[model samples]
Target: MTFRKLMIAGAAVALLAVGATAAMAQTSAQKALIDAAKSQGTVGEQADGYVGVRTNADAELRAAVDATNNGRRAVYARSATEAGTTTEIAAARMFETQLLARVSSGQWYRNAAGQWVQR
Candidate 1:
């Protein structure tokens, strides 16, 4: 193949690989943090398409929440772009229709009014 063509193909491959990595499921550490946070009522899903602290948390827990929520925001931003909607609308729709179902009873979550409540 021509060098220019080869470069293009290589770029495409790299892009696809990055996309695949992004599509992979969350890491074990991430899962564990989220689980612990939920159980402890330290973090929970919010109506804004991201997770947040339901109550005060230690530094480690706070960091985990921040990481997870940041990841969620990136996803929400992409979904919003694809759906031609605002990020807040996209997040609210996901929280109301899908994310809430994953939350366990007694877990803390932010309701539509942004108030924290136990699920």
Candidate 2:
């Protein structure tokens, strides 16, 4: 094989390897959150009012803040009360904007396909 052809093949292989590594390393942090959420005792016994199971949501929020400019994002949810055909509800998104801001700046970016891809 020609030297030029060999060099091109080597470059392609290296690029593929780097891409694979990035994919593999793509956000083990989310798993960390899920594991924490599933664990017991983190929320404490007989806890009430948005209590979490194993992970501290506050700590995670703070961590997101710290991950500024690193592509971190926050997930949010709220409790709702639906009464009539038009649901009457109260919404609480305490960490919504902050989390999104963290995500906008952190290491979270979508791929060319518009799917979530790690940076």
Candidate 3:
């Protein structure tokens, strides 16, 4: 393979790894709360690669969502730097290729058109 092609392949692998790592970075408690909230239709994954509250959120749920988004932001920022892109682009790519794929059936996610969709 050409050196350029090899580098592109490596970067793609790294990006995928980073997305998976970010998804698993949450604490058990946070994950539990987020999962519960998602099941309840109170919160969902946003297309911009952040968590969104569909209804009024209590302190605990809100905190968990905040922590989750914070972790995602960190990952997106690092990936963006490595990829020579903006954080928003990195986040969108991660959402489309990685995070959105992990959404379970009956869970909620915001579509790119800002519509809340159930997976």
- lDDT for each residue of candidate 2 in 1-119, tens digit (9 for 90 to 100): 97644543343333333334433443677436433432322321111111223334566743432342122111111111111111111111212212223233223323223343332
Q: In angstroms, how far off is 40's CA in candidate 2?
A: 38
Write one digit per residue (lDDT tens) for candidate 3, span 78-107.
Answer: 877776767787777767766798788999
lDDT value, residue 38 of candidate 1: 91
lDDT of 3 at 5: 43
**CA lDDT, every model vs. true structure:** 0.68, 0.29, 0.82
Between prediction 1 and prediction 2, the one with superior lDDT is 1
Worst 10 residues of 2 by lDDT: 83-92
Candidate 1 residue-wise lDDT, 83-113, digit = tens: 5556566566667666788789999888879
Candidate that scores best on TM-score = 3
- lDDT for predicted candidate 1 compared with the true structure: 0.68
For model 2 the local lDDT of residue 19 reads 33
Candidate 3: give the clashing pairs.
Answer: none
Q: Count the backbone clashes (under 3 Å) in each candidate.
A: 0, 9, 0
